[model samples]
Target: MVNLKLKLSEKANYLAFLIVFVSLGLASQSILAEEVHEPAEQIAPHQEQFEAGKFVIEHVSDAFEWHILTYKQHHISIPLPIILYSNNSGLNIFWSSKFEHGHASYHNFRIEEEGEHAGKIVELNEAGAVVGLPIDLSITKTVAGIFISVFILIFIFLKVAKSATSSTGRAPTGIQNLLEPIILFIRDEVALPTLGKDKSERFLPYLLTLFFFILIENLVGLIPIFPFGANVTGNIGVTMVLALFTFVITTFSGNKHYWKEIYNPDVPWWLKYPLPLMPIVELTGVFTKPFVLMVRLFANMMAGHMIVTVFVSLIFIFGQIGGPALGGAVSPVSIAFSVFILLLDVLVSFIQAYVFTLLSALYFGMATSDHH
Candidate 1:
C-alpha cells in the first residue's frame, strides 16, 4: 500500500509540473484593461466594446511608452523619449507624452490613429494631412528591455567569474555554485560532443553566451513588469538578429571540407547533373538552417504568450455577456487553466534555450568537421 501511495504521489508531482504559462503577457495583462482610452462618450459604440485581441497584440508588441499598470480605469505609463528627424522638421525632439495617448498632436507631429501609419508618429502638413514619416530612433520598450537584460547578464557572469576564480580549489558557493552545473552541462553535453575537444574549447564561449542570453531573455519576458518583461525572444527582429549571428559565425567557421560538401556534394552523378537539384537543395539548406532557428524560437514564445492571454480573456468575456455573478463563477476555472499553461511555459523556456544552443553547436560541428 505504501509503495502504491508513493507511486501515486510521484505521478501527482509530475502532473503538477505540467501546470500553466501565459504567453507574452502572462498575469501582467488585464482583461478589462483601460488601454490608453480616450473619453468613453466620444468613442464609437463598437469601439467601446472589450477587445481581448487588441489587448493581446498591444501586450506583446513594442511601444513608445512603457505601460506600468491600470488603476481606477486610468492607464499608468512611463512615456519614453521621441527622437524624430525629417527633411521638413529638421529634428523634432520630445517626449512620447506630447502625443497624449494618441489623443493630441505636438509641434507639427501626430500619432496616427488609423490607416497605414496607425500607432506611428507621422509628420503632418500645415493643412493636417500626413505628408511623410520622420526617422524615429526612439528607445522603445523592447529596446529598453534588451539594455536591462544585457546589464543583468553582465552583472551575473562577472560575479560568477569572480567567485569561481577566487575559490579555486574550494567548492563553489552562492550564484557561482548554482550556475556551475548548468555551465558544465553546456560544455560537456552540448559543446564537447558536437564540436569535440579542440573546437569545443574554442567555441564554448559563444555557445555559453548564446544559451544564457536566450534563456535569460525567455524567463525574464514572463515576468510582466518593467525591466522584467519585454517579450525579447518573442520579437522576430531580435530572433532574426540572433539567428544571423549564428549564420555569420557558421559561414566564417566553414572549412574547405564544408564548402566542398555544399558545392560538390557526394551523390549519384545523374541526380547532380540532370537539373542541379541536389546542389540547389544543399545551398538552400545553408540559409534555411538559420531561418528555422529564428522562426522556431519566435513562434514558440509568441504563441505561448498569445494563448495564455486568450485563456485569461475567457473570464472577462463571460463577465461582460452574463454579468458579474456568472463571471465570478467562471473565474476560478479560467484562472486554473491559465496557471496550468503558465507552469508548462516555464519548462518550455529552458527546453528552447537548450535546443537553440544544441542546434547551433551541431551546425558549428558540421561546418568545421574533419570527416569526409
Candidate 2:
C-alpha cells in the first residue's frame, strides 16, 4: 500500500511538471509573436531607437505632421511605413540599427532646402511645398489599395454582367458565380428590405461600389505590408467623400413628399402657425445624417486598430522595466485578445459595409417614395 501510494504521488508530480512545461512553451510563443510585430513608433521614438522583439507597433498612429512653408501655407504629410520581420529586412527602404529589422518609408518626398521646418513640412523656394503635396495624386498605400480594389470589383462585376447577358439569362460562372450570390443578397436582404425593389435598383450600383470598396480597404489595412495598411476607411477624408456621395444621391432623388416633410412638416396648428423653426432644424438634419455616418465609421475602425496597438505595446513597456517575467506571463493574454480583436475587426468590416449600404438604400427609398 505504501509503495502504491508513492507511485501515484510521483505520477501526480510528473503531470504537474508536464502542464507547467506546456504552459511555458505557449507563453514563450505568445511573447515572440507579440515582439515580432511591434509597431514602428513603439519600437523607436524617431526611427533611430528601435529594439528587438518590438517591430510591429513602432510607427505613428496617424502619421500626420504639418509643415509650414516659406509661402506661409500649411501643408500636411503622413508617412506609411512598411512592416517586415527581422529576416525580411532586405525589403525595407531603410534598415533600423536599433530595431535590427528593415523598414520601408512611405510618402517619401523632398522639401526644398530653403524652407523653415514647421514640424514635418518645409518651405520650398518657389511655393511652400508640403513634403508630400497633392496627396490624391501620389502613389500612396491608400491609393494603391483603392486602385486594386476598384480594379478587382470593376473587373469582376463587368465579367458577371457580360456573362449574364451572354448565357441566355443563365446564372454566372467562376468569379461571377462567387459574386452573384453576394449581389443578390444585397439586393434582396439589404436593398429590398430597406429601400424596396423599385427604389433599390436605382441606388444598387452605388451601394455595391461602396460595399466592395470599404470591404477591400478594410481587409487590406490588416496586411501590414508595403502598399497596404493605409487605414483607408478609417481616414475621415475618405469617409467624408463616401458620405457626401450618398448625401448627394439621396438629396437629388428626393421626391416631393420628402422635401415637404422637411421644409413644411405637418405639425400641430400652433407649431406651424408660430413658424416654429422646424424647417431650419430639419434642413440641418439632412447634412448631419451624412456627417454622422462619416464619423461613426471612421472612429470605430480607427479605434479598434489603436486598441490593438496599445495592448501590443504593453509587452515592450513592461520588458523595459525589469519585469520581463511578468511581461512574458501577460503576453499570452494580450496576444490572444489582440487576435480576438482582429477577428472582430473582420466581422466589423463586413458589418460596416453592410450597414452603410443598407442605410444609404433606406435614404434612397425615403427620397423616392410616393408618400411622405
Please provide TM-scores, in order, for all candidate models, with all chains considered together: 0.85, 0.65
How far residue 80's Cα lies from its native spot in candidate 2, in Å, is 9.4
- On a 0 to 1 TM-score scale, where does candidate 2 land against the true structure? 0.65
Q: Write the per-residue lDDT of candidate 2 for residues 1-372, one digit (tens) a residue.
A: 222222322332333333323322211110001112334454544424325333333231323211111121211222322222222122222112222222222323232323353212221223433433221222233443454555555555555555655664454567657765676677678877778766665666666666766777777776555445666777776788778878998998898999998889887667656675787788898998899889988888887777677668777667666567977987888899888888898999888888887888877887787872
Question: How many clashes in each candidate?
Answer: 12, 15
- For TM-score, the strongest prediction is 1
Off by over 4 Å in 2: 1-122, 125-137, 158-174, 323-327
- Taken over the whole model, the C-alpha lDDT of each candidate is 0.76, 0.57
